[model samples]
Target chain A: MLVRGVTGMARVVPETRDEILAAAARRFAVSGYRGTSLQDIAGEVGCSKAAVLYHFANKDAILTELMAPAIGMLQALDERIAAHSGAAAQRVAGEGFVDLAVRFRREIALLRGEFPELLQQPAFAHIQRISERLIEALAGHPERPAARIAALVVLAGISEACGEFADIPDEELRPALLALVRRALEPVD
Target chain B: MLVRGVTGMARVVPETRDEILAAAARRFAVSGYRGTSLQDIAGEVGCSKAAVLYHFANKDAILTELMAPAIGMLQALDERIAAHSGAAAQRVAGEGFVDLAVRFRREIALLRGEFPELLQQPAFAHIQRISERLIEALAGHPERPAARIAALVVLAGISEACGEFADIPDEELRPALLALVRRALEPVD
Candidate 1:
């Protein structure tokens, strides 16, 4: 199959669903979910819109596919954190959250600024629940306002770091981000 | 003039453009920019869509007006911070950024998750520039990658705190957010 590379040159490649998803994810990250259209994705993928629809039911389907891996990983981390207690759980939650943010930086960047619109779609409902669980774990399941606020700041801080430092290779960004999160989560003397 | 209170009961009062903007701001903050329509604003204000259109040219107009004050205040803060040097500038930027977030908590909530969409609208162009300046100020105008990353984290942390803790009166949230920013900005000694 022929695909248009970033240089606009025609190159032979396998026409696979992953290619379509990669194109969609790139477009969504750059243009935003609301700003991107299925046609746009198809254009980027060098396929017909109907061909794109053949693999995914709709744009929401594409988004669901794009985020499913990250969501699954988060849910698994949520369960693991739940199985722990105190500082252990907070540590697990913090590390897991940052790892996921680093791994899925593009998806995070795409959704971070478009959360309100994402919430309105049924496909993204699990995000809120997963995020709340992560926060709860990060706060060590505490009911105190300070812990909750701290957890939120850490989460937001990591997310924003990942999004803004997208050009930085993950290996370099991951430790830097984890260090920041650790400092932010430290108890105030 | 009549307006609909939060209880859905009609209250007789003088209808004014401020009322429409207030209603639109509330709706946008709660439901999001794309989720809201002029009719929704009109319904909230107990006025007609025509009345809303009479005051504002379009939805973007309402959003522009809603954010103008915050933008102006941020620009002023930017100028003030620009006059300072090194740690002094960073300190001023941190406090001013958090103060602005606390003061315009509702507006922050409305815009926090809608940045990509806002960028598409020409009315919000200055937000990008102001945000860059704030980030630079927060970094003490440093050229280091770590400093830049730290500044981004501080800004995002305070914003997320304000948006999530909107119900916690500004007086209470201000100190907590400032404390978080201060800690996040500390050097990694």
Candidate 2:
């Protein structure tokens, strides 16, 4: 019984860590990193700061981990866009982008809430590269760099609208938002 | 000679403050508020933190002040769009919106980067309201709500391209960006 209990307790460790991450993301998103404390995260997780530290070396580590899903989702969406063919591909890619935008509010808000200085950090270089690559891929018209610009604008537009103005109902907003992006990607006269 | 020196020094004060603000905006745009220190700003100004603070109360105050021109510029853009009259209002608005997007790199970046959460704070309610009103006025497409969404999307699109992706060169990149916004604002088929 003791060995069984130990195994069970071990399983809960990862779960607890995830709980801490979730709590931290929420806190960091709503309250800027400076405004939040490990103690606050501990309180939210019903654990000690030591335990939180065991999961993450520090606040920055936790934040970087919390933001992983957002980055991953964006990359995955790009892959999905590449895989899909025809109108279905466009719709799927657009929806995935929209879904990520709507759901990744905390991560997006946290990033936007911080300064661009975050971009200069070597740790975030992957994100920049990914963003640039995504733009390059999305710009089907190499002749008109506007397509690339439009892609970025659409990407940023969705992120801002979803993150800051989430109070607006998604059902009412998604179609219009998607329509706007579609228009943005279209050729100019 | 003494009176002349006093007048020259007095003129220098505002000029110095403007220079400081410019430096702060550049640093803050690149490094963010937490990453930046008064010493950094002071060093750039060839002074000390005490001297920096003499010009502004604190980093928060500096941030708030940094927003003044951004707010004014957006407000002015709003006025320009609202007052635009004639057959090509949509087309003209698209061009004007793109112009604002290119020029608003620092302002949009600062707002989206450092002040996103500040939107929820009671103190920044006025600022929030101003942006909201501006967005509403810009996107007031009488034909449909999609127009409104498109307007917000265009603003957001530019923000994403310029604010976060600061590495992109302007001369080579802006035409594409402007084209994207122009397409986004065009009447839907």
Q: Every prediction's TM-score for the first chain?
A: 0.83, 0.66
Report lDDT (CA) for all predictions: 0.77, 0.65
Model 2 spans > 4 angstroms off: A1-18, A32-35, A78-96, A102-110, A115-124, A164-174, A187-189, B1-18, B73-104, B119-124, B141-149, B164-182, B185-189
Ten-residue region with minimum lDDT total, candidate 1 chain B = B3-12
Worst 10 residues of 2 chain A by lDDT: A1-10
Encode model 1's per-residue lDDT on B15-101: one tens digit a residue: 579889889888987777877888999998888899999998888888888888888888889888878867888888889988898
| Candidate number with greatest TM-score | 1
lDDT of 1 by residue, A1-189 (tens): 363465755554555577889998888877777778889988887778888889988878988888888778878888888788788878888888878888888777767666656765777677678788788777664576766777888887667555677898888777877776776675522
Off by over 4 Å in 1: A1-12, A186-189, B1-12
Cα RMSDs of all predictions? 4.3, 6.4
Q: How many clashes (backbone atoms < 3 Å, residues ≥3 apart in a chain or on different chains) does model 2 have?
A: 3
DockQ of 1: 0.56
